[model samples]
Target: MNDKVKALLSILESAGFSHDDLAGTVAELNDAVNDGKSTSIQLVSPGAAARYIKRINDENVFTARFRHSDEPDLLNNESNDERIENPNQDSCIVVSYDPAKQ
Candidate 1:
């Protein structure tokens, strides 16, 4: 894997994010990079990645796939499961638009 990917994955893992969480986080970060929201081609470093991940997670920036319903049966249902939270929650992954480049 590339340095950016490795760094990002390591950072996420250290911040209590599971492998699946890292996967989604990487996807979102890639999208940001592709969209020109972020200028850097790769994650700065494992330290930088860790800091960013912690910053985002602290901001409670996460998205989930399922919604909870107010039903006693559903609460007890075995099929009920928490949604897979999205990596782009609460603007955790920050993208600062540099006007100097404009």
Candidate 2:
């Protein structure tokens, strides 16, 4: 695996995702590459991503924000102020990857 994939897997693993839970995500990423398109991996939940951000000691490898699924364009800043000020179950975290970037 490339360094980016390795890093992402490490983050997910640290976030408490089991290997079984990551199988589908791995498959999806492979499929996206085969099809020549960019892709994003949706974590198990917003809470899981939040846990990773809060618990992991690494310099931020991923950006987390609060975005309501229905709004799509409405995302809080990278600082996550909105998420902290107002938690919403309707919001979901979208983790997008740029494979071309090292």
lDDT against the true structure, per candidate, is 0.39, 0.53
Using lDDT as the measure, the top candidate is 2
Which residue pairs overlap in candidate 1's backbone? 61-89, 62-89, 63-85, 63-86
Compared with the true structure, the alpha-carbon lDDT of candidate 1 equals: 0.39
lDDT tens per residue, model 1, 1-102:
444445545645665556764565477655654455533221223223435544433432221112223211222242434432443221233323222343
Off by over 4 Å in 2: 30-36, 46-48, 53-91, 99-102
User: Candidate 2 has what TM-score?
Assistant: 0.51
RMSD of 2: 7.0
Q: What TM-score, over all chains together, does every model reach?
A: 0.33, 0.51
lDDT by residue (1-96, candidate 2, tens digit) is 444455666776776667688888767765655555566665535355665654333443333444454443322333433333343545455565
* Steric collisions counted per model: 4, 0
Point out the worst 10-residue segment of candidate 2 by lDDT. Answer: 74-83
